[model samples]
Target chain A: MDRLGTVAVVGVGLIGGSIGLALRARGLAAEVVGVGRDLASLQQARERGVIDRATTDLSRGVAEADVVVVCTPVGRIAEDVRHAAELAPRSALITDAGSTKRGIVEAVERSSPRAAEMYVAAHPLAGSERSGSAFARADLYQDRVCVLTPTARTASDRLRRAREFWAGLGCRIVEMGPAEHDEVVAYTSHLPHALAASLAAAVPADWHPLAAGAFRDGTRVAGADTELWTAIFRDNRGPLMNAVAKLQDRLSSLKYALMNDDEESIRRWWSDARARRLLFEAQQPPEA
Target chain B: MDRLGTVAVVGVGLIGGSIGLALRARGLAAEVVGVGRDLASLQQARERGVIDRATTDLSRGVAEADVVVVCTPVGRIAEDVRHAAELAPRSALITDAGSTKRGIVEAVERSSPRAAEMYVAAHPLAGSERSGSAFARADLYQDRVCVLTPTARTASDRLRRAREFWAGLGCRIVEMGPAEHDEVVAYTSHLPHALAASLAAAVPADWHPLAAGAFRDGTRVAGADTELWTAIFRDNRGPLMNAVAKLQDRLSSLKYALMNDDEESIRRWWSDARARRLLFEAQQPPEA
Candidate 1:
């Protein structure tokens, strides 16, 4: 892989800024150009050295980039891709860092028909409670899994190029159909967010003041960017809804057991879940 | 506070062993006596110097100590308190580290008629995912809230002595009634555990192999020690049940909003939760 080339990252927030920082640290890009509507954030990103140069003009940022990575909120991913596509020249390999795949794929396919062949849908399974370039670490993606959802119509060379790029950043690649990806994340990611938020909301509005550290830790996900989450839940409504229903069923079972004083059933339920979680914990690092 | 008295740690598990270690670290106790059935764990505690002595003979251990802290599983607290009452010297102060309070109070009132006057109920709002003496850390309770739930009948001098002992180990004290303590914990702790476990159980049994990091992070509490938790929930059943009901009701409301595609309701729920969590996260750390 070339050590130096122009790379443009759209939406210079946490994900975008992290990508630029990672690229710069690895010497993978000569000029890391950032594009975002917030001029103040762009300036902050520059002072923080997350990017070599940045601009509010999306077209100017993408026109000459060798690689264009869209790192916008889930809601704006497709729109960002469409705008970038109009400015990106031929041979520019584009990709995304969106959590969901199907919507981004559909949006890019419809709005950026010319750049469809160059775009690869990718999701890096990593983050922190803090956001923006200031918190970005070069090794954020180290040993983390990055799922790439590529359809049959996706260009083989573009897919190969995208895989090579993420691999260089030390991310293990998992390939799956977009629908399958959505379903898995619905259970693993989206449902957890909704569950945490609902648990937080369930605190009688009057009781929120009395909540302690455990409640705060358990509901940490409830504090995530609401606009981003709303877009995700809306875009992946089908799988997310299914995941929610399944979770509600399990909760209902536990509630019934507790209500009826079914000690044996409740213990068995907890025991089974504990065993599974122990196995899962053995495989991963302490979550950040 | 003279640091020359024998300290009896009743359970000799994570919290107890950690307390033993912390006691020794501060030179606050002349001897650390560990009481538990497991000889091997007692040996480990001795080897690690968490305790100066260890034994399975609860009667002898309790009789030898000037200050006896009940660190057993919540279900076992009453039994331990009763047994200790028979053997513990007249002047020894008895305290507990149970998550719930009302049940412990009831148990103590029922089982240890003689020691009720000396008993000081306390809940140290501190713990970790790891367990056993091997994982014990002397500083675990540092800068954490330690609530003392004393009944009107509790001896003020003994309560003051216990509070000073805890302060020596570096803890900020909060006082609450047993009933209020139980209710607060149900909302802050027990309810979250139930939700985390239920979420884990909701994953299709066949899908366990495919369950990934996000699911694992979401369900981390599901991996907690079941026996200890079972004891907690069983002993604290009334308030735990109340909290679960409130949580279930909250979950149902969110489910209804999702099912009806009520975007406005969902937004309000998410925003409210996000607001509260941000507030909690931004608050200063608890005084030790």
Candidate 2:
């Protein structure tokens, strides 16, 4: 596989900025250029050493890049792909770092007519409650799982290079179809975000001051950028909605058992959940 | 208020062991004696400097203690309270660190029929994924909240002493009725655990190996000891069951919006949850 050379990262937010830092810090990329809407933020990212050259002009950043990673919000990925495709160097591999896959894949297909065959759908499964480039850390991806969704049209050589690119950044690469990826993440990630958000809403303002560590930690992810998650849930509506329905059904069963004072039912309900969670928790952290 | 001196911690597992260590490190207690079901665990606690002494005999530990704090599973709190009550010094003030309030309050009432005036129902909202004496940290309670349930029958002097004791250990004390406390925690704590468990169960086994950081962090509290959480849920059945019903209804509404591709409804469903969660998350590291 050809070594990932000059790279352009569109949108120097937490995920984008961190990927740039990690690529450079790991010697995976010789040059890392950043593109963003805010010129001042790009300059800040450069001064902080997240990128070698930073520009507000998407054309300037992607003109000579060998690899381009689109890191815009779900709603805007199509526009970004279109912009990057026009400026991208010939044979440059394109990919994204979005949470949902199907919408973004469709966006790429529609926008990047030229780079469509080179594009791959990827989601790097790492983030912190803190946002912005200032909070970006090169080590954030270490031992984390990063998923790649490649369609039948995607070039084999490009797929290999994308896998190598993430592997170099210390991520264990997991490949799946875009549809399967959405279904899995809906239950594992999106549903939890929704649950946390709802739990926070249910608490009265008077009692909020007294909310303990459990509530705070449980709802921490609920504070994630609203616009971004709004688009994510909107894009992955089918699978996420399915997961939500399943969860509602289970919760309803538990409520009935509790309301009816069915001690045996309650005991079975808790024991089952406990068994699976404990097993998951016991798994070894991916080989460091 | 009488100075907290020679605090006795019964059943030195996570909560009890940590309390002993925290009291000793902060000089909140002159001496701490650890009482446990297992002699080896008690011995380990003492040797680890969590307590000044260790004993398997409940009577021996309670004889000279100015304050006795029971930290065991809620199912056994009554039996343990009765055992310690028989040997507790008449002037000693007794409290517990169980998750449930009403059941434990009733247990304290029944166990110490004569000395019930000296007993206070308390629950300190501080813990970790790690358990046992080995995981105990001195500053575990720093900036944490502790709830004190003082019924009309509860003595004012006993309440004052319990508050002072917790305050010295770096807990901000809040007053609430047993019923109210359980109701609030049902949404804030219990229901969240149930949600976590449900989400964990919903994930496919194949995806379990590929579970990412968010899934792990989101479900950390869900992997709680089954026996402990079971006892707590059962003890606070009325409130927990009520909260579960509300959560299920809310979740069902969310499912409906998602299933029907109702963008406006989904947005409204998540907007309030997101706003409230953001507000809660904005309150970082509570005032020390």
Candidate 3:
């Protein structure tokens, strides 16, 4: 793996803090700079040894950096990337850890064509409902899947650099187009969050205490931060709506089977579900 | 708690085997007998120290037992309890670990009004998607919720014994009517399983590898045994069906919000879900 001179991590939240810690722990960067809107949070990250330097000024943080990684929420990712373009070194590889890529990629490319050559949008498929620097961990991305949504506008060198950066943190690299990444994650991530929220709301508060493994596991993601997820939902609304409609259509079929007391059909559905879930369980990491 | 001279556990699979292990570990019973249709499985239970004895003959297993627990699938719980009533000692406490209460309780009382004096319907809110005796653990029920559904015909002494028996196994006891148990679990347990299956079935197979925490957690219960869960869904059809319908209705609200890009309403739903899930997490055991 290639070592870096300076790495600026914008937003200094869970994803940013983890990146800083991983880079610092591996001795991969000469300097790891934490940049955020809140000086207090960036100071806390510095105090906790997540970063060697803390700065509220994005320009001061990335002005001399070899790589700039933006780990802000979906809504702020493109703006931060664009801001980095104005000050970051011309040779710097600019990347982001946004959950949604198409909107950000398009927005950044539309603003400045030169920025696309330096930017390669990526999403690491490992995060918890809990957020912030407090919950960040150095090994958060180890052995997890990280998707790189590269466009034709993306420079080959910068794409490779983004892949190496995430790989250095122990992520298995995968490449998909921006639209495809959005579609796949609409079903894989966003749709499940929508379903969890709906499932959590459907159960009455009085009956929640008796809930055990099934209820707890099923509704786990409903504990996620509302503001962050709501923006992702709106940003990727088209594909998410399609996924939600498909789930409803499938539930309708099961509903009809239950209404008619069609044991054979219902059993067939359960059998398929059990087989599918087993296959998924096998593909996941042991702890997952 | 009163010590048991002998205990017969029918259908010694995951639930029955766990009960046998817990009883043996706590020295609650003199002998824990395993009974099932498969002599091979019963023998395996014995070999693994999950039970003191193994028998394919249900009558022989329960003949001299002080307590007879029917841990069979929902479809056969009533039949097993009635069989025990005919052969077990007059002092035996006849109980079941069926997920649904009203169906089993009504069937037993209808068959022999005298059996109600000994029978108690209970649902131990434990067990895993993985079945069979191999996965059984002595601590499976520790600090878990176990609801005892006592009927009007249920003898006061038998209900007390049932409560003591589960509590002895480290359960947190809750009392509800047979009908109430079905309704509560229909929302808490059965609805979640149904949603998990529907969600699992909706996602394309190729996209499964990309599924991270939300998809895995949301669809965890879909891995449950087909025959066992199908029987539960059928046995608790009225309430379960109502629960499935309510989930579909709730998903519709989220779908509309997505279609219209209604950020405010979507955030509201997510906010409510987060609060409800926090309350549930607070109530559940730490390991859950």
Candidate 4:
């Protein structure tokens, strides 16, 4: 396996720290630099062996890198990607781990031509409700899907490098049109988050004692980082609202069934849902 | 430490089988009789040590019992409880483990005078996505909350006996009005189920491969029994509808935030949900 000379991980949070750790652990990168706003957090990441070097200066941090992975919040990913592209060597590849891709891809296209050519929009579908460097693990990307949304203007060499980088970290890569990626993820990820938060908010304080495993499992994602998810929802608002509308339609049908005491309709609805879930579970790769 | 001479368990499914296993394992009952429509399932329950005896004859099953715990599907619970009440000794206590309470309590109240006096509606907040006797465990009720919804017409002696029975199975008992129990559980249990099912239903078939931990956790309850949940929705329609409305309101606010790109509103909604979930987690008893 060919190893990169240097890999700069901007933001150094859970996703970035995990990428740094995985690359270092796999001997895929000779030097892993942690870049962030907080010097203390970057230093902590270095101390934890998540990175080999730490720097609060974005330009200085990415200057010597062969690759730069922008791991900032969804709202900041485009700017971070553009900055990484401007600072890194001409041959260096730049990519991001933003949950939403269309905005980032379009914003990167509007950046300087050289920066646009270096950037690939990527979203690795791997994370927990917990966040930050402390919770990062080397195996976070193992057996998970990482979607790459490359525009027609994206350089082929850079896109290949982005795919190789994620593959090196054990992610199974899938390429999708940015708009399609946003729409699919809206149903699979964003809508679920919204529903979880809504369920959590609907629960009366006094009803907490009576909640069981079902309630706990259903609302687990409601505990995810607020700022990160808010940015995601805002960035992909159009597709997310469409997803919400579809879910509302499904819920309304069920509500109507219950209201009418339509046992057959309710049974069919739940049965179809169960069948779909079982199919989805069947499609999952075996646990590592 | 006092044990009932005999305990009759109606419907040898997960809850019923679990109750039988716990009663026998803890020596809370001298004899545990399994009763259901399927003779083979009853025999299987006996063979698996979930019961000491098996019977398809409801009358014969409850004839010698000191207590009868109705564990049939939500739709059948009322009738099963009434049948158990008619068959059991006049001194026998009757209770149920239906997820919804108001309908069961009302139906029992409309039953014969003896049945009404003997019945106490109970809903145990413990279960997994998996169902049936094969998954039943003796420790299912350990440290779990079992809500006893007793009406004004419920006899004091029977209520006391019902409390003792669940307590013996390691359940912490809480008494609530039947209507209150229905309303509370609608928010905590039924609404979550409906949302999980709807989310599962909304995901496109192609999106399943991209689904990760968040989707799995959000839709876990969509795998629940269809007929069982359908009956529950029908039984608790009013309160469940109210719960659905509250969830819709919360979701609509988030939708408005997303549509307007109001990051602050989105952040605050998710942050409040996170804070509430943290508080709920803090209040939970240590996992057994």
Q: What is the interface RMSD of each candidate, in Å?
A: 2.7, 1.9, 1.0, 0.9
Off by over 4 Å in 3: A285-288, B285-288
lDDT of 1 by residue, B1-288 (tens): 777589899988889988999999999988999999998989989999899999899888988688899998887887787778778897888898888889788778766557788788998877765678898889988877788999977888889888988887788788889998888777777888887887777765544434444465568778778877777777677777777767667666666777777777777767887887676666646541
lDDT of 4 by residue, A1-288 (tens): 478999999998999999999998999999999999999988988999999999999989999999999999988988888888878899999988989999888888898898889988899999889899999999999989999998888899888889999999999999989999998999999998989888887897788988988889888888899889988999999998888878888888988887898889989999999999888888877772
Question: Could you give candidate 3's fraction of true interface contacts?
Answer: 0.89
How good is the docking of model 1, by CAPRI class? Answer: acceptable
Model 4 chain B lowest lDDT segment of ten = B279-288
| Cα lDDT, model 4, residue A73 | 94
**Candidate 3 CA-lDDT value:** 0.90
- TM-score of each model, paired residue for residue: 0.92, 0.91, 0.98, 0.98
lDDT of 2 by residue, B161-207 (tens): 98988888888899998888888788877877877777777776567
List-wise, what DockQ does each model earn?
A: 0.46, 0.57, 0.84, 0.83
State in Å the error of residue A119, model 4: 1.2
How close to the true structure is residue B157 of candidate 1, measured as C-alpha lDDT?
A: 85
C-alpha lDDT score of every prediction, in listed order = 0.80, 0.80, 0.90, 0.89
Q: Could you tell which candidate, 1 or 2, scores higher by DockQ?
A: 2
Error of 2 at B216 (Å): 1.4
Model 4, residue B140: distance off in Å is 1.2
Best by lDDT: 3
Chain A: TM-score in each model: 0.93, 0.95, 0.98, 0.98
DockQ-superior candidate, 3 or 4: 3
Q: Which 10 consecutive positions of candidate 4 chain A have the poorest summed lDDT?
A: A279-288
Is 3 or 4 the stronger prediction by lDDT?
3
Give the 10-residue window scoring lowest on summed lDDT in candidate 1 chain A: A205-214
> How does chain A of candidate 2 score by TM-score against the true chain A?
0.95
